[model samples]
Target: MDTPLINALEALKKENRISFHTPGHKKGRAYESMDDGGIQENLYQYDTTEVFGTDQLQDPTGAIKESQQWTARVFQSPEAYYLVNGSSAGVLAMILSQTKPGDEILLPRDVHQSVIHALILGDLTPRFIQPEIDPQFKIPKGITLPQVQEGLEKYPKCKGVLLTHPNYYGRPGEIREIRRMTREFGKILWVDQAHGAHLGLHPQLPLSGIDAGADLTVTSFHKTLPAMTQSAVLFAGGEVVDRERLLEQLNMHQSSSPSYILLASIEQGTRHYAKAGKEKMQVLLEAIESFEQKFRRLGLFQLDTAPGKDRTKIWIHTENSGRTGHEVETYLRENHGIDMEFSMPQGLLALTSIGNREKDLKKLYLAFEELEETLYNKVKMEKFSEKYSKEAKEGFFEKEVERDKKEPLGLPIRTAFYSRKERVSINKSVNRVAGSAVTPYPPGIPLILPGEAITRGHRDQLLEYEKRNIKVIGIKAGKIMVVAEE
Candidate 1:
């Protein structure tokens, strides 16, 4: 297929004086990678501006528009927009475009921070529907039907229902049921499917948000598909979404000087997936299942529930072997030179995407075999013996949201996000209203949000996370940010 966007960039490179445009890099002169020879040259050479022939992102008609059309067809959406800045931009644009200021929206509490940002920026009120927590993994699974129905009932003025399908752990929910309910209530559905870019491309994967009839869906192609980091696509499906407003917001959220390199990545990646995704996914699933069999036969590792999951994600419970997820993460990196996606207190996430080679799976099996031995010995030395933790066998995840009793939800997120704030000791911050979100970086879910009263539970969680070397954003040096007292 003709990669129009990439061809345009290559043609510009042939022009030789493309530097006369804008990007001060001047095509690999000052800013080449450490490699300095291969794709680095082309990468900088094609870094371009909205010159005469190159179509503008805000108003596309040429190569850029053509690339988007190809992407839409492949993703099974009526309309698609390339996002240079990642799914965050799409998320903010979708919310602000669909809902009026002060309009209520039903959402899961486990939503990405970008959703919280949209709530603040768009002045949209949120009625949080807590997602069902997996007791064994402690990670939030899919949102339950009762939770969504209750939120919509409590907030009768809700204009839209926003959700995350195939959550961080690859748990696929009843997206079809949610779609049916939203349609019955005359509410638009917006999905933040950042991690489900490969959905609908393969039969084994879950139904995509577009397939589930979402009005607007945002996907980060970088998450699962063969794409560069920060590349994403915004899918518009149902007629409920206003294309004009979506486009306007897309233009507003993104920068004028969008990266040609990123745009070409989306185009090139989409082209490849459209042709070969099904074959690739089939092979990947086979390799993953083989590895799972190898691990299960040994009976050394505790595997997560697989009844409803994307299958590409590999989550192993380390608690059984008397190891924290952080410890396992460190072991994988330091011992095997393999960096994993994310690790929680009880489980570690290993992602298998189109980037993996069959040999990579082979190596992964070997590495985990070695890891299993180390964990067994550690448990033995600690007097836990050859037996695994019984709780781990069944799973040990947090089942529900344990709200802080003292610090109740105080103000709207928008008001508290903009309020004057001060940083205080983590202990002293208790009972004060939060001025900013304090979220764990990997999951990006707010443990404490702006306008929520900080309680003892919040303080303890942050402090424990601090000890574990986990990143807590919106805090300064060891202190938490809180609304300053007048």
Candidate 2:
């Protein structure tokens, strides 16, 4: 793996350059990482300031440019840029660069919290394409072409659509059809492919966003690939996205001093994918197949292999097996020393990649086998959801839906974000115009957004989530910020 970024860092460090750099570390001499048991010496050496050979990340001219070009080539993207600040930065950058405040951007309701933040920063009006919620898994499936068509038709002034190729639950969407429609309608297509970074690597994978002709596709390489956390890549697929403006937006969000270690990891991951992605993915697929066959016979767990879903992620539903997603997660962690990707209310998502070890998976199977016996011998148990919310006959999410039916947008999102607001208790927050997003952080989905009229039901749901220890952002010190009364 030829990492130009790492090579530059190593060569610069080997030369033993003197002081007089923006970074106060001065080549990790004064940094306590060397003395104390902090970051390794190699990281300190590699973590250099943007000196002569070390190219600037904002305006990549040398190694960064070369590395990104290789990345583009490997991914078959027209143009690509490194994102050190994760896909969150990429999502924000795309929205900021392409759409202006008050512009309408149609998207699915189940988007990441970062998208909500981006909507706020851009002050863009969001027209949500109602996602088909999976009855079995309770997760929102990706938007279809018909939904996109309806959104566009409903919101005539909508500039573009931001589609999440694969929802966090490993459900993929109709990217190719959506792309074709976006082109036909002369609308920009931004695919938030935070989970599809390794899509093109294997033939078994679903359609890659760039190949599907998305205007702008941003991927968090760390999510599914062997890249370091916070490592991501942004692509300018079509003429819709202005490359220079995208770069400018990236610079606005990205750190002035980017991490060489993360940049090098991105390069290395790309190189690895180019070399052995197919073979590795095949092995992973085979292993998963074997695992599934064995698990299916056990008659305990259920898998979500719905159409258009990613094969790399194993979505295990333990409802029939008498286990909650969190219980399964805890068992897998404490009993088997295996931490799953995420545990939703319906099921647990186990992330398997080309990099996953066979022995580790085998161990996971053994753990499941143990879990079956343990659960089998045990008496009847109450469901986690059932244990909570004695008052609400419907499930927690159903209550949320009932709340959402209360009212519509109070004002434009742009106006609401910029308006003078006051903090109020959850009880008093009803009928007040929301000044910010109230989101569930784990899934990173916002329940309510700025300018939306907060209802009593919405407040109750927020309180329930808080009581359950689930993080609800935008509520500070038992108060929610909302637009003040004139």
lDDT of all predictions: 0.76, 0.77
TM-score of every candidate relative to the true structure: 0.87, 0.85
Worst 10 residues of 2 by lDDT: 30-39
- Among the numbered candidates, top TM-score falls to 1
The C-alpha RMSD of each candidate to the native structure, in angstroms, is: 8.7, 9.1
Candidate 1 deviant stretches above 4 angstroms: 1-41, 298-300, 379-408
**Model 2 TM-score relative to the real fold:** 0.85
Off-target runs (Cα >4 Å) in candidate 2 are 1-41, 298-300, 321-323, 379-407
Model 1 residue 27 CA deviation (Å) reads 22
Candidate 1 similarity to native, TM-score: 0.87
At residue 333, candidate 1 shows an lDDT of 64
Evaluated against the true structure, the overall lDDT of model 1 is 0.76
